[model samples]
Target: MIDKIKRIVEPVVQDFNAELVGVTLKGAKRNYILIVFVDRIGGVTIEDCTKISRQLSKEQELDDLLGNNYRLEVSSPGMDRPLKTPQDFKRNVGRFLEIEFEDKAGLHKLK
Candidate 1:
Protein backbone atom coordinates (compact mmCIF):
# COMPACT_ATOMS: atom_id res chain seq x y z
CA MET A 1 0.00 0.00 0.00
CA ILE A 2 2.68 2.44 1.02
CA ASP A 3 4.86 1.47 -1.91
CA LYS A 4 2.02 2.17 -4.31
CA ILE A 5 1.38 5.56 -2.77
CA LYS A 6 5.10 6.34 -2.89
CA ARG A 7 5.25 5.49 -6.57
CA ILE A 8 2.33 7.77 -7.28
CA VAL A 9 3.47 10.73 -5.19
CA GLU A 10 7.24 10.67 -5.55
CA PRO A 11 7.24 12.25 -8.99
CA VAL A 12 5.08 15.10 -7.78
CA VAL A 13 7.42 15.71 -4.90
CA GLN A 14 10.43 15.56 -7.17
CA ASP A 15 8.80 18.10 -9.43
CA PHE A 16 9.09 20.49 -6.51
CA ASN A 17 12.78 19.59 -6.18
CA ALA A 18 12.29 17.77 -2.89
CA GLU A 19 12.91 14.28 -1.70
CA LEU A 20 10.03 12.07 -0.66
CA VAL A 21 11.15 11.04 2.79
CA GLY A 22 8.43 8.65 3.78
CA VAL A 23 4.74 7.79 3.69
CA THR A 24 2.53 6.45 6.43
CA LEU A 25 -1.07 5.28 6.58
CA LYS A 26 -2.87 5.33 9.88
CA GLY A 27 -6.26 5.31 11.62
CA ALA A 28 -9.28 3.04 11.16
CA LYS A 29 -10.76 1.44 8.06
CA ARG A 30 -13.00 4.28 6.96
CA ASN A 31 -10.89 7.01 8.51
CA TYR A 32 -7.51 6.21 7.10
CA ILE A 33 -4.93 9.01 7.32
CA LEU A 34 -2.21 9.32 4.73
CA ILE A 35 0.87 11.13 5.93
CA VAL A 36 3.62 12.16 3.52
CA PHE A 37 6.97 13.40 4.74
CA VAL A 38 9.18 15.38 2.40
CA ASP A 39 12.55 17.10 2.67
CA ARG A 40 14.99 19.06 0.53
CA ILE A 41 18.59 20.25 0.57
CA GLY A 42 17.59 23.43 2.38
CA GLY A 43 14.66 21.82 4.26
CA VAL A 44 10.98 22.09 3.51
CA THR A 45 8.58 24.96 4.01
CA ILE A 46 4.86 25.21 4.74
CA GLU A 47 4.30 26.56 1.25
CA ASP A 48 6.20 23.63 -0.17
CA CYS A 49 4.01 21.21 1.79
CA THR A 50 0.88 22.97 0.64
CA LYS A 51 1.91 22.84 -2.98
CA ILE A 52 2.81 19.17 -2.75
CA SER A 53 -0.42 18.39 -0.91
CA ARG A 54 -2.58 20.10 -3.47
CA GLN A 55 -0.85 18.44 -6.40
CA LEU A 56 -0.90 15.04 -4.73
CA SER A 57 -4.54 15.44 -3.80
CA LYS A 58 -5.39 16.13 -7.39
CA GLU A 59 -3.43 13.10 -8.56
CA GLN A 60 -4.98 10.83 -5.95
CA GLU A 61 -8.45 12.09 -6.76
CA LEU A 62 -7.95 11.27 -10.42
CA ASP A 63 -6.58 7.81 -9.71
CA ASP A 64 -8.83 7.02 -6.72
CA LEU A 65 -5.84 5.31 -5.20
CA LEU A 66 -6.74 5.74 -1.57
CA GLY A 67 -10.46 5.17 -1.86
CA ASN A 68 -12.94 7.80 -0.64
CA ASN A 69 -12.51 8.65 3.02
CA TYR A 70 -8.83 9.15 3.52
CA ARG A 71 -7.29 12.38 4.71
CA LEU A 72 -4.03 13.38 3.10
CA GLU A 73 -1.31 15.13 5.06
CA VAL A 74 1.97 16.46 3.76
CA SER A 75 4.75 17.67 6.01
CA SER A 76 8.35 17.38 7.08
CA PRO A 77 9.78 14.51 9.07
CA GLY A 78 10.38 15.98 12.52
CA MET A 79 13.45 16.01 14.71
CA ASP A 80 13.01 12.48 16.03
CA ARG A 81 12.28 10.93 12.67
CA PRO A 82 13.41 7.36 12.13
CA LEU A 83 16.36 6.69 9.84
CA LYS A 84 14.93 4.43 7.16
CA THR A 85 17.55 4.52 4.43
CA PRO A 86 21.26 4.99 3.80
CA GLN A 87 20.50 8.48 2.55
CA ASP A 88 18.81 9.28 5.85
CA PHE A 89 21.89 8.15 7.72
CA LYS A 90 24.16 10.14 5.43
CA ARG A 91 22.08 13.25 5.88
CA ASN A 92 22.36 12.93 9.63
CA VAL A 93 26.06 12.32 9.68
CA GLY A 94 27.87 13.60 12.80
CA ARG A 95 24.71 13.26 14.84
CA PHE A 96 24.26 10.86 17.73
CA LEU A 97 22.47 7.61 17.11
CA GLU A 98 21.47 4.48 18.99
CA ILE A 99 21.22 1.38 16.83
CA GLU A 100 19.84 -1.99 17.74
CA PHE A 101 20.36 -5.28 15.97
CA GLU A 102 18.10 -8.31 16.13
CA ASP A 103 20.95 -10.82 15.95
CA LYS A 104 21.46 -10.92 19.73
CA ALA A 105 24.36 -8.52 19.58
CA GLY A 106 22.90 -6.08 22.11
CA LEU A 107 22.24 -2.37 21.53
CA HIS A 108 24.90 -0.26 19.86
CA LYS A 109 25.05 3.40 20.74
CA LEU A 110 27.04 5.84 18.57
CA LYS A 111 27.82 9.49 18.35
Candidate 2:
Protein backbone atom coordinates (compact mmCIF):
# COMPACT_ATOMS: atom_id res chain seq x y z
CA MET A 1 0.00 0.00 0.00
CA ILE A 2 2.77 2.42 0.90
CA ASP A 3 4.74 1.59 -2.21
CA LYS A 4 1.65 2.20 -4.29
CA ILE A 5 1.19 5.55 -2.63
CA LYS A 6 4.80 6.44 -3.40
CA ARG A 7 4.44 5.47 -7.03
CA ILE A 8 1.32 7.56 -7.45
CA VAL A 9 2.81 10.51 -5.66
CA GLU A 10 6.32 10.52 -7.10
CA PRO A 11 5.38 11.17 -10.70
CA VAL A 12 3.02 13.92 -9.70
CA VAL A 13 5.93 15.68 -8.03
CA GLN A 14 8.24 15.03 -10.96
CA ASP A 15 5.70 16.64 -13.24
CA PHE A 16 6.28 19.84 -11.32
CA ASN A 17 10.01 19.67 -12.15
CA ALA A 18 10.90 18.35 -8.72
CA GLU A 19 12.65 15.12 -7.89
CA LEU A 20 11.05 12.74 -5.44
CA VAL A 21 14.04 11.81 -3.32
CA GLY A 22 12.27 9.48 -0.93
CA VAL A 23 9.20 8.62 1.14
CA THR A 24 9.20 7.50 4.74
CA LEU A 25 6.59 6.01 7.05
CA LYS A 26 7.16 6.22 10.75
CA GLY A 27 5.22 5.85 14.02
CA ALA A 28 3.17 2.68 14.04
CA LYS A 29 0.60 3.60 16.65
CA ARG A 30 -1.43 6.21 14.80
CA ASN A 31 -1.70 4.36 11.51
CA TYR A 32 1.61 5.82 10.32
CA ILE A 33 3.37 9.00 9.31
CA LEU A 34 4.04 9.66 5.67
CA ILE A 35 6.86 12.00 4.72
CA VAL A 36 7.42 12.82 1.10
CA PHE A 37 10.69 14.40 0.02
CA VAL A 38 11.03 16.44 -3.14
CA ASP A 39 13.92 18.45 -4.57
CA ARG A 40 13.62 21.42 -6.88
CA ILE A 41 16.44 23.41 -8.47
CA GLY A 42 16.58 26.34 -6.05
CA GLY A 43 15.62 24.48 -2.92
CA VAL A 44 12.17 24.33 -1.35
CA THR A 45 10.28 26.94 0.54
CA ILE A 46 7.65 26.72 3.25
CA GLU A 47 4.98 27.38 0.66
CA ASP A 48 6.16 24.35 -1.31
CA CYS A 49 5.77 22.16 1.69
CA THR A 50 2.31 23.50 2.44
CA LYS A 51 1.16 23.09 -1.13
CA ILE A 52 2.37 19.52 -1.47
CA SER A 53 1.04 18.57 1.92
CA ARG A 54 -2.39 19.89 1.05
CA GLN A 55 -2.55 18.10 -2.26
CA LEU A 56 -1.25 14.83 -0.86
CA SER A 57 -3.65 14.96 2.06
CA LYS A 58 -6.59 15.24 -0.29
CA GLU A 59 -5.44 12.37 -2.45
CA GLN A 60 -4.79 10.07 0.48
CA GLU A 61 -8.14 10.90 2.02
CA LEU A 62 -10.07 10.46 -1.19
CA ASP A 63 -8.52 7.05 -1.81
CA ASP A 64 -8.76 5.96 1.83
CA LEU A 65 -5.20 4.87 1.41
CA LEU A 66 -3.69 5.97 4.71
CA GLY A 67 -6.36 4.39 6.89
CA ASN A 68 -8.45 6.57 9.21
CA ASN A 69 -5.80 8.50 11.08
CA TYR A 70 -2.30 9.38 9.94
CA ARG A 71 -0.08 12.36 9.48
CA LEU A 72 1.04 13.22 5.99
CA GLU A 73 4.05 15.49 5.66
CA VAL A 74 5.23 16.67 2.30
CA SER A 75 8.38 18.72 1.96
CA SER A 76 11.77 18.96 0.36
CA PRO A 77 14.36 16.39 1.37
CA GLY A 78 16.20 17.87 4.35
CA MET A 79 19.90 18.75 4.61
CA ASP A 80 20.43 15.04 4.96
CA ARG A 81 19.06 14.05 1.60
CA PRO A 82 18.19 10.38 1.94
CA LEU A 83 20.47 8.01 0.13
CA LYS A 84 17.70 5.57 -0.61
CA THR A 85 19.14 3.71 -3.59
CA PRO A 86 22.34 2.96 -5.45
CA GLN A 87 21.24 5.45 -8.04
CA ASP A 88 21.52 8.11 -5.39
CA PHE A 89 25.25 7.45 -5.21
CA LYS A 90 25.65 7.57 -8.96
CA ARG A 91 23.66 10.72 -9.28
CA ASN A 92 25.72 12.44 -6.59
CA VAL A 93 29.09 11.35 -7.83
CA GLY A 94 30.81 14.70 -7.52
CA ARG A 95 28.88 15.97 -4.55
CA PHE A 96 30.21 15.96 -1.01
CA LEU A 97 28.83 13.12 1.11
CA GLU A 98 29.16 11.77 4.61
CA ILE A 99 28.23 8.19 5.29
CA GLU A 100 29.05 5.30 7.59
CA PHE A 101 30.03 2.39 5.43
CA GLU A 102 30.11 -1.13 6.70
CA ASP A 103 33.39 -3.07 6.19
CA LYS A 104 35.01 0.17 5.03
CA ALA A 105 38.18 1.63 6.47
CA GLY A 106 39.17 5.08 5.23
CA LEU A 107 37.71 8.01 3.37
CA HIS A 108 37.80 7.97 -0.42
CA LYS A 109 36.65 10.34 -3.09
CA LEU A 110 34.96 9.46 -6.36
CA LYS A 111 36.24 11.22 -9.42
Candidate 3:
Protein backbone atom coordinates (compact mmCIF):
# COMPACT_ATOMS: atom_id res chain seq x y z
CA MET A 1 0.00 0.00 0.00
CA ILE A 2 2.84 2.34 0.85
CA ASP A 3 4.62 1.54 -2.40
CA LYS A 4 1.45 2.29 -4.28
CA ILE A 5 1.04 5.56 -2.45
CA LYS A 6 4.64 6.49 -3.21
CA ARG A 7 4.23 5.59 -6.83
CA ILE A 8 1.09 7.70 -7.03
CA VAL A 9 2.36 10.58 -4.94
CA GLU A 10 5.93 10.95 -6.22
CA PRO A 11 5.19 12.72 -9.47
CA VAL A 12 2.75 15.11 -7.87
CA VAL A 13 5.28 15.95 -5.19
CA GLN A 14 8.09 16.50 -7.68
CA ASP A 15 5.89 18.83 -9.67
CA PHE A 16 6.39 21.22 -6.77
CA ASN A 17 10.13 20.42 -6.64
CA ALA A 18 9.82 18.48 -3.39
CA GLU A 19 11.04 15.01 -2.51
CA LEU A 20 8.64 12.55 -0.95
CA VAL A 21 10.50 11.39 2.10
CA GLY A 22 8.04 8.81 3.33
CA VAL A 23 4.40 7.69 3.65
CA THR A 24 2.47 5.95 6.38
CA LEU A 25 -1.11 4.73 6.54
CA LYS A 26 -2.91 3.83 9.72
CA GLY A 27 -6.35 3.31 11.30
CA ALA A 28 -9.39 1.27 10.53
CA LYS A 29 -11.18 1.10 7.19
CA ARG A 30 -13.34 4.06 8.12
CA ASN A 31 -10.69 6.35 9.52
CA TYR A 32 -7.45 5.83 7.72
CA ILE A 33 -4.79 8.47 8.15
CA LEU A 34 -2.23 8.90 5.43
CA ILE A 35 0.83 10.84 6.40
CA VAL A 36 3.26 12.03 3.74
CA PHE A 37 6.65 13.50 4.52
CA VAL A 38 8.13 15.93 2.02
CA ASP A 39 11.47 17.65 1.86
CA ARG A 40 13.80 19.58 -0.44
CA ILE A 41 17.21 21.32 -0.41
CA GLY A 42 15.94 24.49 1.26
CA GLY A 43 13.41 22.66 3.44
CA VAL A 44 9.65 22.67 3.04
CA THR A 45 7.11 25.23 4.21
CA ILE A 46 3.43 25.26 5.19
CA GLU A 47 2.55 26.58 1.77
CA ASP A 48 4.41 23.69 0.22
CA CYS A 49 2.49 21.28 2.39
CA THR A 50 -0.76 23.04 1.58
CA LYS A 51 -0.10 22.90 -2.14
CA ILE A 52 0.89 19.25 -1.97
CA SER A 53 -2.21 18.40 0.01
CA ARG A 54 -4.48 20.17 -2.41
CA GLN A 55 -2.83 18.56 -5.40
CA LEU A 56 -2.88 15.11 -3.86
CA SER A 57 -6.53 15.42 -2.91
CA LYS A 58 -7.26 16.43 -6.45
CA GLU A 59 -5.80 13.17 -7.78
CA GLN A 60 -8.52 10.77 -8.86
CA GLU A 61 -6.18 7.81 -8.77
CA LEU A 62 -5.37 8.49 -5.14
CA ASP A 63 -9.05 8.51 -4.28
CA ASP A 64 -9.47 5.06 -5.76
CA LEU A 65 -6.17 3.95 -4.25
CA LEU A 66 -7.25 4.63 -0.71
CA GLY A 67 -10.99 4.33 -0.98
CA ASN A 68 -13.30 7.15 0.13
CA ASN A 69 -12.71 7.54 3.85
CA TYR A 70 -9.24 8.73 4.72
CA ARG A 71 -7.45 11.87 5.80
CA LEU A 72 -4.18 12.95 4.22
CA GLU A 73 -1.49 14.91 6.04
CA VAL A 74 1.50 16.54 4.44
CA SER A 75 4.40 17.80 6.51
CA SER A 76 8.12 17.74 7.13
CA PRO A 77 9.75 14.97 9.15
CA GLY A 78 10.74 17.59 11.70
CA MET A 79 14.01 18.66 13.26
CA ASP A 80 16.09 15.83 14.78
CA ARG A 81 14.56 13.38 12.34
CA PRO A 82 16.85 10.37 12.03
CA LEU A 83 18.92 10.15 8.88
CA LYS A 84 18.27 6.80 7.26
CA THR A 85 19.77 6.67 3.76
CA PRO A 86 23.15 7.60 2.31
CA GLN A 87 21.46 10.38 0.40
CA ASP A 88 19.86 11.66 3.55
CA PHE A 89 23.20 11.79 5.29
CA LYS A 90 24.81 13.43 2.28
CA ARG A 91 22.14 16.08 2.10
CA ASN A 92 22.60 16.92 5.76
CA VAL A 93 26.36 17.23 5.56
CA GLY A 94 27.93 19.85 7.87
CA ARG A 95 24.85 19.79 10.12
CA PHE A 96 25.20 18.43 13.65
CA LEU A 97 23.90 14.89 13.97
CA GLU A 98 23.27 12.34 16.67
CA ILE A 99 23.49 8.68 15.71
CA GLU A 100 22.63 5.78 17.97
CA PHE A 101 22.89 2.10 17.19
CA GLU A 102 22.73 -1.19 19.02
CA ASP A 103 25.25 -4.04 18.89
CA LYS A 104 26.38 -6.93 21.03
CA ALA A 105 27.76 -4.33 23.40
CA GLY A 106 24.20 -3.03 23.85
CA LEU A 107 24.36 0.43 22.30
CA HIS A 108 26.63 3.07 20.86
CA LYS A 109 26.31 6.68 19.83
CA LEU A 110 28.10 9.26 17.68
CA LYS A 111 27.64 12.98 17.62
Candidate 4:
Protein backbone atom coordinates (compact mmCIF):
# COMPACT_ATOMS: atom_id res chain seq x y z
CA MET A 1 0.00 0.00 0.00
CA ILE A 2 2.76 2.43 0.97
CA ASP A 3 4.86 1.63 -2.06
CA LYS A 4 1.84 2.24 -4.23
CA ILE A 5 1.31 5.63 -2.62
CA LYS A 6 4.98 6.50 -3.06
CA ARG A 7 4.91 5.68 -6.76
CA ILE A 8 1.96 7.98 -7.23
CA VAL A 9 3.36 10.86 -5.16
CA GLU A 10 6.99 10.85 -6.23
CA PRO A 11 6.27 12.21 -9.67
CA VAL A 12 4.01 14.90 -8.35
CA VAL A 13 6.62 16.04 -5.86
CA GLN A 14 9.30 16.07 -8.52
CA ASP A 15 7.08 17.98 -10.88
CA PHE A 16 6.82 20.67 -8.24
CA ASN A 17 10.61 20.70 -7.84
CA ALA A 18 10.32 19.03 -4.47
CA GLU A 19 11.55 15.70 -3.25
CA LEU A 20 9.77 13.06 -1.23
CA VAL A 21 11.21 13.45 2.24
CA GLY A 22 9.43 10.42 3.58
CA VAL A 23 6.17 8.49 3.90
CA THR A 24 4.60 6.88 6.92
CA LEU A 25 1.64 4.59 7.62
CA LYS A 26 0.39 4.30 11.15
CA GLY A 27 -2.61 2.67 12.76
CA ALA A 28 -4.34 -0.65 12.64
CA LYS A 29 -7.60 -1.82 11.12
CA ARG A 30 -9.87 0.41 9.06
CA ASN A 31 -8.61 3.74 10.33
CA TYR A 32 -5.15 4.14 8.84
CA ILE A 33 -2.94 7.19 8.36
CA LEU A 34 -0.91 8.19 5.37
CA ILE A 35 1.69 10.83 6.19
CA VAL A 36 3.74 12.18 3.32
CA PHE A 37 6.85 14.29 3.56
CA VAL A 38 8.27 16.72 1.04
CA ASP A 39 11.38 18.84 1.00
CA ARG A 40 9.48 22.08 1.08
CA ILE A 41 10.58 25.52 2.13
CA GLY A 42 8.25 27.94 3.95
CA GLY A 43 5.96 24.99 4.62
CA VAL A 44 3.33 23.64 2.27
CA THR A 45 0.08 25.51 2.02
CA ILE A 46 -3.35 23.95 2.46
CA GLU A 47 -3.87 24.40 -1.26
CA ASP A 48 -0.72 22.41 -1.93
CA CYS A 49 -1.92 19.70 0.40
CA THR A 50 -5.30 19.66 -1.26
CA LYS A 51 -3.82 19.45 -4.71
CA ILE A 52 -1.53 16.58 -3.79
CA SER A 53 -4.31 14.84 -1.91
CA ARG A 54 -6.67 15.13 -4.84
CA GLN A 55 -4.09 13.89 -7.29
CA LEU A 56 -3.26 10.90 -5.12
CA SER A 57 -6.89 10.17 -4.37
CA LYS A 58 -7.76 10.26 -8.03
CA GLU A 59 -4.94 7.92 -8.87
CA GLN A 60 -5.89 5.52 -6.13
CA GLU A 61 -9.55 5.55 -7.03
CA LEU A 62 -8.86 5.12 -10.72
CA ASP A 63 -6.68 2.10 -10.09
CA ASP A 64 -8.62 0.77 -7.09
CA LEU A 65 -5.23 0.30 -5.55
CA LEU A 66 -5.93 0.49 -1.85
CA GLY A 67 -8.46 -2.33 -2.22
CA ASN A 68 -9.41 -2.15 1.43
CA ASN A 69 -11.21 -0.14 4.05
CA TYR A 70 -8.88 2.69 4.98
CA ARG A 71 -8.56 6.43 5.06
CA LEU A 72 -6.01 8.61 3.33
CA GLU A 73 -4.15 11.65 4.68
CA VAL A 74 -1.92 13.92 2.65
CA SER A 75 0.23 16.62 4.20
CA SER A 76 3.71 17.96 4.53
CA PRO A 77 5.98 16.63 7.27
CA GLY A 78 5.57 19.71 9.43
CA MET A 79 8.29 19.99 12.08
CA ASP A 80 7.93 16.45 13.30
CA ARG A 81 9.67 14.62 10.47
CA PRO A 82 13.02 14.85 12.25
CA LEU A 83 16.53 15.46 11.14
CA LYS A 84 17.62 11.90 10.56
CA THR A 85 20.64 12.96 8.60
CA PRO A 86 22.94 15.93 9.00
CA GLN A 87 21.55 17.27 5.75
CA ASP A 88 18.06 17.24 7.21
CA PHE A 89 19.20 19.19 10.20
CA LYS A 90 21.06 21.57 7.94
CA ARG A 91 18.03 22.17 5.79
CA ASN A 92 15.81 22.86 8.77
CA VAL A 93 18.18 24.93 10.79
CA GLY A 94 16.60 27.76 12.79
CA ARG A 95 13.17 26.18 12.65
CA PHE A 96 11.36 25.01 15.77
CA LEU A 97 11.15 21.24 16.18
CA GLU A 98 10.19 18.49 18.57
CA ILE A 99 12.57 15.56 18.26
CA GLU A 100 12.50 12.21 20.01
CA PHE A 101 15.58 10.18 19.35
CA GLU A 102 15.81 6.41 19.58
CA ASP A 103 19.43 6.01 20.59
CA LYS A 104 19.68 8.93 22.97
CA ALA A 105 16.91 9.86 25.36
CA GLY A 106 16.73 13.64 25.40
CA LEU A 107 15.07 16.64 23.85
CA HIS A 108 17.47 19.25 22.63
CA LYS A 109 16.93 22.43 20.64
CA LEU A 110 18.56 22.73 17.25
CA LYS A 111 19.88 25.84 15.63
Which structure among the candidates has the greatest lDDT?
3
lDDT of each: 0.83, 0.71, 0.89, 0.67
Q: What is the lDDT of candidate 4?
A: 0.67
Q: Is candidate 3 or candidate 4 better by TM-score?
A: 3
Candidate 4 wrong stretches, greater than 4 Å: 27-32, 60-63, 93-111
> Candidate 2 vs candidate 4: which has greater lDDT?
2
Off by over 4 Å in 3: 101-111
User: What does candidate 1's lDDT look like per residue over 1-111, in tens digits?
Assistant: 778888898999999999999899998667789999998756789999999999988884424766777888999997677788887877667766666555568666554
Q: Write the per-residue lDDT of candidate 3 for residues 1-111, one digit (tens) a residue.
A: 789889999999999999989999999777889999998876889999999999999988878977888999999888778888886766677767788899998999988
Name the TM-score of candidate 4: 0.63
- At residue 53, candidate 2 shows an lDDT of 72
Clashing pairs in 3: none
Instruction: Please state the error at residue 23 of candidate 2 in Å.
Output: 0.6
Clashing pairs in 2: none
State residue 82's C-alpha deviation in candidate 4, in Å: 1.7
TM-score of 1: 0.73
- The order by descending TM-score is 3, 1, 2, 4
Q: Which residue pairs show backbone clashes in model 1?
A: none
